[model samples]
Target: MSYVNQSQTLNVTSEQKYQGLLEKVLLSTLIAMPCCVFLFINGTMLFTLRSKSVFRGTSRYILLYNLLFSDTVLLALSQFLYTLAASKIMLSYPVCGVFTMLSILTDEISPLTLVVMSLERYVAVCYPLRHATIITIRNTGVAIIVVWAFSVLNVFIRVVLLLDFPFSDLESLQMTDVCSDIDMILSPMSDIYDKAYTGFVFLSAGVAVISSYIGVMIAARSASTDKASARKARNTLLLHLVQLGLSLSSTINNPLLLAISKTVSRVVFARMQNFLYVCFFILPRCLSSLIYGLRDQTIRPILVYYLCCRLTLSPQPKLRPKIHGVN
Candidate 1:
């Protein structure tokens, strides 16, 4: 077999083996109430920021917009799927296929968008002078278009592949309506294609983001020009690093952990894989709100202002003191 053919075969085998695990976990992902809360907060922040001119024109605003859109869409899409499944809604063949396509698209897009945000910050901080020219509003718009276009292009393959394979084969005996036909529908070539595409997305967006922050930190070390500015830059970079680290660890390790749990005979390893996934994906999803809420200067201030405004109104001072004349 040629290299491409071998790669395709390996991916198909892996997909088939992992199909059960992915569906089981993906279905359970909908039960997360935190998803709704996070989406609401992020949506509100995006709206407020965009309403103000300061957020609309800045590069950070562009990144924030993309990030908020990505997460909100993912949560919404997940909830849709989970709700349908939970309510026992039987979807048509085409609808089921579309749901699967969208689920993957949204999930993938969230990480890819984060990658873009990271890269934007990296370029702005590391190449401060050039950032203005490189990350202009027009360019940021194009970059976002590229991210969506890429996701759509890749996800559409599912439709064609599913049409080629009948869903009847993968149906569970226990639940006939819920489709279990992911791998059977995926083209044999899907893995090679996806791996290449996912790798590009990770390196171009994810790695670039990390590298940018690293560059900024290194530059900040030697520049004694303004202590306060340098300190703030370092803190921002550190927070970005933390977010990136969490994301990268999940993207890279989750698959490997699953593969090991499958390939190895030991039951403990499989259990460990479950543990790591919760730590990586679930925990991060729940905690990212708190992380950004506290550490992100842009987001933190808005939240503080919102909270203070809520607390300071004093509720009209409760006027019950004028009844002494009647007594």
Candidate 2:
């Protein structure tokens, strides 16, 4: 009996140690991956910005750059919150509310920007001759500005209304050490508004993306001479669809998981929630940057060349200069 008791104790101790190690590993990954993603995205944006003549002037690259910028900001904010949570630091209600509002703004902007990008691709692929005239740099810039302004206004209004809600008394709520998804609560009216807002934005964007891709397919099917170009267009559209799915999942997954986990043990729910947060929210943001860099023909070469130059500490090869004929 003594030996058996000792063996059982030893096994329990070992399991506890393993669980502790696993949690640390996960925390480290949750912290490190977003930082790496932010760096990679900003680096690629810098590279694109440097080649202004080729990339900066194009409408597609302009939309893509904005998308990158938004995603980078989102990742940075997420990392900041993650670090604070890891350190067991609690933000005051107002500060947490600000961070939450900023995060939502960036989150909304990402998918909205993607919607514009898909529409731009649709025009480029389906209406090749008119793409340049229609999707001009100035027009694209104006559209981007509108997107930012609208996102800011929308989020600000929602936050203000939330503050005004009778049930949303920040002073009455207990403050915790970690500002996490579970800490946020929406009054009934705000909850309704949130659902409506999410549905409208996501549904509209989905419809636009789906319609644009459908148009691209129809155009590709009718074209006889540019089969290769059509295939490339289809591939790019598929990539955009994948990215869209990933972005939408971040919005949908959390609520679904919360509903399902309601009856589960608190310990299990907490672990599952954190895991899902990292998988659905953080992982998708990181992959978005990778997907864009790898899949974009124009950006791919530049990203690869920049990475190579950085790794080797060597100057990039210069492009052959255009020569003008003597008049």
Candidate 3:
């Protein structure tokens, strides 16, 4: 009776192993499909931004390029790690560190870049005369650089905290748990520091975006302000706030999943996690392309053209007569 009552399996069978593998494949495939689609869209958007001189020359467009570049890389890295975890692959400490670090580095850049973009819009509406001098190409490039440097500094602190772990004591560097940033939290201090850092970054970013929205709204009411331009700027700032909120939501994925796991069965938890991963992770990154590409009149046609595999979506321009009146 006692033997029959044992719930744990001491011996693993080949059939059970195959069943596990099959389930993993099924789950990963589901996530990978949408991830691939988003990646394609993001790639096309990135290429479209670079293809036009107008896009390349404009300050806001340059900032948009920086934002999309980070989002694209973050999405790709995340999917990679997700696939590895789903496949039950465990990476060594060093290998996983590099992957997660790159992931975090890119992940942090999105919100900060959004803040810069928001400020650019705010200035464009609030101080139209100075906008040209203020939001110059060189200044935008410097702002992009600063955003990256700040994110890198955050990642550097994380690396320092990781060193607190007694890695040398282990017989081998092979990690027993699935490789992830959460798994790498080997100490209480590390977890606390991560929470504090994430909270501060997101809170600061939220404030900056909201403040910009308010500034733009105030500028819209000014008598001298261009109503149409201010209205457009106001709308864009609102969308930036939404995008920042979505990015902020991603930082809570681990904590949220942990809370949900206790109340649900293992199977149910797994399903919920897969669903939430796509909703919280993939959709947020995909949003940037959709928000900018579909909404902006300037980008809409060219973006659609590239997205549809270079198929023309607009009326083709007629060629003018060549030299010597050649038609």
Candidate 4:
């Protein structure tokens, strides 16, 4: 009877392990489907932006391209890192640093680019006569350059703060926990700086977007302003606020997940985390694509054409070439 009980206990343990594995696989699949869909949509949107001379030359479109490009890069890297964590793959500090740094670099670009785009829209709506001169192609290029330089500067600061950690004392560089940005916060200053920098960037960006929204609203009242243009710009700025909120929320998800875990069972926490990852990370990256592709009259049909790849559902018509009989 003792031996029989031991066998039974072993069977139960094996079953539990199998169940846990199955749950993780299911969650990963659920998360991956939406992420892949969003990635595809974002890719299609990027291609659509570059496919036309008009899109390439337009300042807003140029800013849109930069925004979508960074968002897509961050989304892909985030998904990859999520998968690694889901599979319990623990990476070495140096290795994880490479991954995290790339992720951070791209992650920072979206919010800044949105701020630039907001200003472009503001000028278009509030100062219509000067829009062409102020938002020239060269000016847009300079804005993009400045945005990237600023993001890189932030990364450099993080690296400098990271140097404060003593790497020589460790027995091994392999991380004790799953590779994540939180895990890489080896020193108090790193964490403090990260929080401080993130807070400041988001605060500044939020104020800028809100200010643009107000500017657009005030302009809407003027007799010189085009009512339709002002209305559209107002709505666009509102959506910019939403995008900024989503981006800001993503930066705080780790703490939110930790709080959530304290109140829920392990199983429940895992499920909630997977759901939140999709909402916070994957979905926001694709909003630029959706917002511009569907909302803009110029891009809606063209975006549809590229997304479908002429799969009979494309908006663009197919042409058949006629051949005269050689005989």
Candidate 5:
């Protein structure tokens, strides 16, 4: 009787552990699928856009391409982190710092790119005659380069400060056993600075996008010529508004998660957070690309062609047997 009870207890424990591992794997897979899909779709879109000279040379497409590139990198990073967490792999401080830096760099650049894109649209709609002069391909390229440089420099400064301030012991920093959101010990000032910087960037981008769209709507409304064109422009702006809202939600997601976490059990909280992450972060990344691919006249055909080719359903010419010696 004693032996049977011990065996039963051992089996139950083993089963619970197995269930936990299964849950982790399933959650990780769930988190990863959307990121993979986003990367594939955006990557194909990037290739298709770049392949055609007509699309490649346009300023709007250039901005869109950069946005896609940033999103792909961001999603790739998220996938990496989630996979690591699921596998119980911890990263050292330096590795974690690098991951954090690159993540921040991409995240910052995404909104900045959107801001530039919105401004580009605003200029095109409000001042159609001078749009070409104001937003040239060369200028767009330069702007993208500048945005990257700024992001890199911003991250570098934060990293330097983080290193300078001893966040626990060096051993702690190098320890790999941590959560997906790496918990780094920062000084009080550093913490404040980080929060302020994040808020400012988020707010600034949000305001710029909203204001640009408003300007575009007003310009479209007042324009006397090309009513149809103006209406189309308004529709495009509305789509952008949706995309912008989705992008900005990342900034707010953390707080919301924290609020909900307090009210839930550990397992429930984890599930809720995972659900939120997929819905808010991963889903939006794909939806943004879908919106652009579906709505943009220049990109729509190429996207459709790419999808058809991917499906192996593109029309093929029927083969004919040539008569021997007919020629």
Candidate 6:
């Protein structure tokens, strides 16, 4: 009877594993398709932006480049993870460490870039005369390099700590792509350190984004020359504010949801966690194509032109040649 009971338990466990695998495969497939499409779209946006005279030498152009680069990298990463899921490529410890390190670094770096962009906009709108003196291309490039270096250095600390983990766990040998064993990695941190670090990153990033937008809003309302300019600035400020809000809320909410899903045996919390992750990660990537790429005039024309050429039997329209005015 004891042997029979043990065999039945093993069967049940195997069934659960199979079900989880199926669920993960389905989710990854759903995530990968949209990300792949957007990756191409963002690529075109980047290309079009580079080829245009309107975007050249502007801070917006630099931001467009960074946004496209970040999104492309992120989309490629998502596709890679999904491919791994499809193949069920269980990674080794070294591969897992590298994957986790890159993911964390990139993830942190993107927000830092956004924060820098917000500050750029703030200075440009709020202090127009001072902006020319303060926020030059050289300074912007330096700031961007600093942000990348800092994020890399910070995330590298986490990577080093992960390497020095004293635990004797078999799970490290068969790591998943999602950075699954965060709790294990956090073991060395005192309660105070963990809380402090989390709060600092989350709060500091949020504050920087918000404050920049607020500065923009005030400057737009107070110093703008025309109603249209003011309105445009207001819209831009609000959009950034909304993006910051969603990102901050999602950042705080995801870990809590994940914690609940792990600690609780209820199906309800598990479903909730899945829903929240979809809302947060999946939604943001999907929206980036529309928000950052599709809205640009240069990109819109190129995309429409390409689509028309591909979809229609009609001949392509000739683009007007650039005329150089006499100096």
Candidate 6 yields a Cα-based lDDT of: 0.64
TM for every model, in the order presented, reads: 0.66, 0.82, 0.90, 0.93, 0.89, 0.75
Show model 5 residue runs off by greater than 4 Å.
1-3, 167-172, 179-182, 223-225, 310-327
Evaluate all candidate structures by whole-model CA lDDT and list the values in order: 0.62, 0.76, 0.90, 0.90, 0.77, 0.64
Residue-pair clashes per prediction, in order, are 0, 0, 0, 0, 1, 0
CA shift at 243, candidate 6, in angstroms? 2.2
On lDDT, who's better, 2 or 3? 3
Q: Pick the candidate with the highest TM-score.
A: 4
- Give Cα distance to truth, residue 57, candidate 3, Å: 0.4
Off by more than 4 A, model 4: 312-327
Q: Over 4 Å off in model 6, which ranges? A: 1-26, 82-88, 167-172, 176-186, 190-195, 223-225, 248-250, 262-274, 306-327
Q: Which order, best to worst by TM-score? A: 4, 3, 5, 2, 6, 1
Can you write out model 2's per-residue Cα lDDT over 5-41, one digit (the tens) per residue?
9999999999997996688668668667767755676
Runs of candidate 2 exceeding 4 Å displacement: 1-26, 29-38, 166-174, 223-225, 309-327
- Residues 189-250 of candidate 3 have per-residue lDDT tens digits of 88998899899988899999899999888878889999999999999999999999998788
Error (Å) of candidate 5 at residue 248 is 2.3
| lDDT comparing candidate 2 with the true structure | 0.76
What range of 10 consecutive residues in model 1 has the weakest lDDT sum? 175-184
For model 4, name the residue pairs that clash: none
Model 1, runs deviating above 4 Å: 1-30, 83-92, 166-185, 224-231, 248-289, 304-327
Clashing pairs in 3: none
